[model samples]
Target: MTAADGVAATVDLNGNFPASPPGSRSKKMVRDGPQPPADPTAVGVKKSGVLWADLDPCDEGRAPTVNGGHADTASGANGANGANGANGANGHHAGHDDGAPDGVPAASDRIDGVLEMLETHPESRVLVLYTGGTIGMVRDQSGALAPLRNRLASRLRSSPTFHDQEYAKRRFGDSDTGPLILPVSSEGRRVLYTIREYDPLLDSSCMGIEDWVRIATDIKAHYEQYDGFLVLHGTDTLAYTSSALSFMLENLGKSVIVTGSQIPLWELRSDGRDNLLVSLLLAGCYVIPEVTVMFGARLLRGNRTVKVSADSLRAFDSPNFPPLATIGINIDVDYRLLHRPKATEPFKVHCKMGSNVGVLRIFPNIPTTAIQSFLAPPLKGAVLQTYGAGNIPGNRVDLLEALREAADRGVILVNCTQCTHGRVAEVYAMGKVLWDIGVVAGADMTPEAALSKLSYVLSKDEWDLATKKEMLRCSLRGELTAPARVLADWDDLDAVVRALGAKPSQTASLLVPAVTCAAAARRGAGPLQAVIDAGADPAAATMEGRTPLHVAAYEGNLEAVRLLLRHGAGVHAKDRFGRTPLVDAVQMDRHEVIAALRGSGAHLGAANPALGDKLCSVAAVGDVQRLESYRLAGTDLCQRDTCGRTPLHVAAQMGRSAAALFLVSSGVDVAAKDLSGLTPAELASAAGHHALANALRSRRSNFCT
Candidate 1:
């Protein structure tokens, strides 16, 4: 399998692996906590009442008024970048050190000591889609706050913090239609962006499956036009929209950040300006490569996030997931938390998001009729936000039967916890009862994510009830955490195997998945032998879909491969990427392992065609993590795309200078020409990426014969 397919985080070496981004997650962090993403925002206030309007997460929000003649000099903080603000009507907060070493070179420079990152790429074109939120709100004649439509750009231009008039005039002289240029960040790259406003605008509470589809389609329509996207949404259901988009935008390889504010931009005090500026910077300067939420100083995974506070500025948090990147003196991205997909196809927008879904928050003495009615016809799926650890009132036989009937009728019910942290598992008898009745465990997924995911999963018309139920358990996006069956009870593999005794086959079946995971941690012949002697299955794979044999080849453990081969491990068995153990060895340049695999009857043509296609896409998207994996896997960097253009050609044509530079360093054919008889540099020039074209041409002589 190729790097694009299901791969583990075991081979982390300077961002050369998918399991972790370089320096984002140190091995120490990987072993300690739940690995990463998700984000949050303000809800108007603490929702209190006897009951919700409906059992579903409804879009009924207090309609905001429009600011027809709002002034530009509104209130907000001078942002963390120290670029756009003078001071807010409320106050200002100082920027803190991101803890990155001070002498670290600017993002545009040839970074020393560490491997090249996509951040080194210059000049990002971004699309700032204003879908209406508190960010653009202003006081109306009635002294009420309302989202202004079609006038966000005008408001942004009024403030020097939001728009740098001097930089724009200097950079785009004589061109009145030049893209707005954000003040260069400390990382040293400018975000050239265009603002697209929704006609009437929307409060996120009004967002649904159709709205999610619209946003996803917009991104797809202009997918190649911009480097990334920043979505401004209302806080009430921002997390829900984020979750919906993550699922809808399948196979995504670019950043999509959703952010808004607790207060309006034109208010005497607001956090809107700071939120907007940071979202712009992140959308352009860095390659986060997942749907994220940026608020306060945290960059989170969109789906995993929940709106924690009603009026507080730091409104969102992902209790089950950690922040992907923290905004401070510098953005500290936990590279390992970034979502790298196994899908090799082009980025697609799943527009068919099913809307016949709702949420049912279970409580004490809830009626059976209500449960039956909620799961009635026309309602295909639902999120059951049950008691802690996914328990329901076990004594209520009527409630149990109602759920069973729903399951029999093909209605999908996912059991998510009402508690803030932890996932739903069948540890308790009550929980097990739900599982027996076909309630899918919603492991650590927020209520918003659970509902949104239910909509997406049920919309898959081709998938049957069984497949949909299984998929609900699987992590399609970073919406839910992967359930890892780890053996945390034992400190080491050998000790555990020893404790199980010499003939442990009967118990080994239960320990097989854990054994495969232990194999990745201890990549040696001694440990493999100890575990094998204890009768752990050799074909078993970890939660990441990597077999023990794959780990041996990845780690270049020749002896480990030999021992596994002797035990009849599949040398040609494919992983998620259609990759064999031999291909893993081939990519790692482990000649000794290569020889051993061939000796064990591995085919010469084991390299994946899917790998090449994914590699080309990664380069175009400037995904340094996946690209680094391709390089380490010894993937042919000279491979061509559908247009007969190499990855270098694609990167250059797409203005992905950083990706192109990475291709050059990885020994791609820089002098090669495409179908148009255009060199990589020529393609860059043809596509108007002048600086990138010039850079490629300058480096071409180094590879000349």
Candidate 2:
């Protein structure tokens, strides 16, 4: 596909492209309420659009046509900076400001005040390129007829609406050489034309192989004639034209503004006036050095804009990019986004385009007819929007046949994912289908990127299939994310931990697959380690019901519990759900880990505040050595476990005399009270433990000292 091929298909008609939807409202005025703080670097005022001119002035008034004014004359007496020779200190005569530069007004700037500032000049040639639109239309006895340029100029000069605009004041000056109006007519009502006073329709879109050749020849033909060039175009395929021009216009130093209005100038609330004013400002200025788009108060690189919305006044938005300049309460220019001119003076233009483009979107249950249609097309290039990680459903012969046919026909198919985030790759068995069928992976490019890349690829006449394939595999403009999912074998749990480490929010950011990957990797030392590594505190407990220690104990992972403890996992931590590790273990009946936890000084009863009696019962019924270990490890001997029996009371009640003796020897007073206020000995006596009662008496006598 070559630039020539794309241009060869162009139909001759009104050159302007699609206008914005009707009845579209402008963005609500910023001045309706309290004003925002002013910024000096603002790009455009609301009404004036923008004023971008190079700082230098020409002594001979022979400025560069693209960046400088269209004529040798000055803009106005205080409207525009004058030629260097005219600079004398006569109170803003050319370079000085003794008083208000222009006599229009002294108030602060407004959204609609962009054109009013030009009244300061007397000698200015404001050529009006009147592409037959409502602005140049007047109703005669016959009907609506295109008015003459001079008449249009007079109407503009007298209208208060024009007075409110800054460009009108600067260009007309309320004096001589009011405002020049030149009318241009095209074929249809749908497609209007915008032309300068001279030769028109030399836009990149209008350039064919022959047109490109001629445009290149024309620049050489009129090398020293014009000041600058401004192109008016439709938005639909503007990027393709811009990209073509950027490639063709090599080492170019002048500015070219490509813009068209959403609403026709004939409409009462049209955007044409603003778009026109700004385009001229850009052309007459000396600052802009590359191909640009001036529309709806924003100036963007011609290649960056995409028509994101169909009907809104803001029809175009550069989603994956920043704007070059924005016109609003004030014009704001992002100097960084602008390209500096090349040192070389002259530039050559190459006008060529390659065709053979195709695009495909894969979805669930995609029909055979749809698949066959794309494969059968006259396509040189294609982009396929695929499923997760570039996967396709099971081998439907039709899907395979369509893809195979396209590849067989020498058409390039590039795979891009439908997912907004993450890359496409061979994650599942189905993903290998596109890879096997010679479909190049796009990694993670937006649809706009896919289209732009396809256009660029097809534009180069000499590039081969192999070269095109390689280009798709590579990243352009930082659009794709490649070599995706390095931790394919990771476990979900581990992924959750890593996600916690990097993003501490409770809501999961990485998807289910990522979670599975994290879990498969490693148990990750311990919950504490995972938590701490994920930027969470080792001491943090679950908001719901369990600390990591509680979970570990409940799961019978004694080692995990120990690791948590060693790393400062709070053993005494209670969950918001009010369960502790020991309590959880007991509830789950994980006796071994529970016994181990008890040995390690875990307070099982404390977690529940009601498990005292149960702990005592378990101690008596279980191994005596483990019981003693629990006691030595700081279990409360006098406190009742869940069953409401203190250790001594349990021992006496069960007639475990040796256990009773150990409790007495371990300094558990038999006189300790239960809920009934009955001492252990009294409860024992009531149940007939006379020996335990005598022992309690002896203990009381010994403690009397």
Q: Compared with the true structure, what per-residue lDDT tens digits does model 2 show for residues 26-46?
A: 211101101111211111111
| TM-score of every prediction relative to native | 0.55, 0.40
Per-residue alpha-carbon lDDT of candidate 1 for residues 564-647, written as tens digits (9 for 90 to 100): 776556553444333456556655556777677655545322122223334555565676655664454444667653234466
Candidate 2 ranges with C-alpha deviation above 4 Å: 1-194, 197-228, 235-240, 243-252, 339-346, 368-373, 376-378, 385-401, 416-437, 440-456, 470-705
lDDT of 1: 0.64
Error of 2 at 415 (Å): 3.8
Best-performing candidate as measured by TM-score: 1
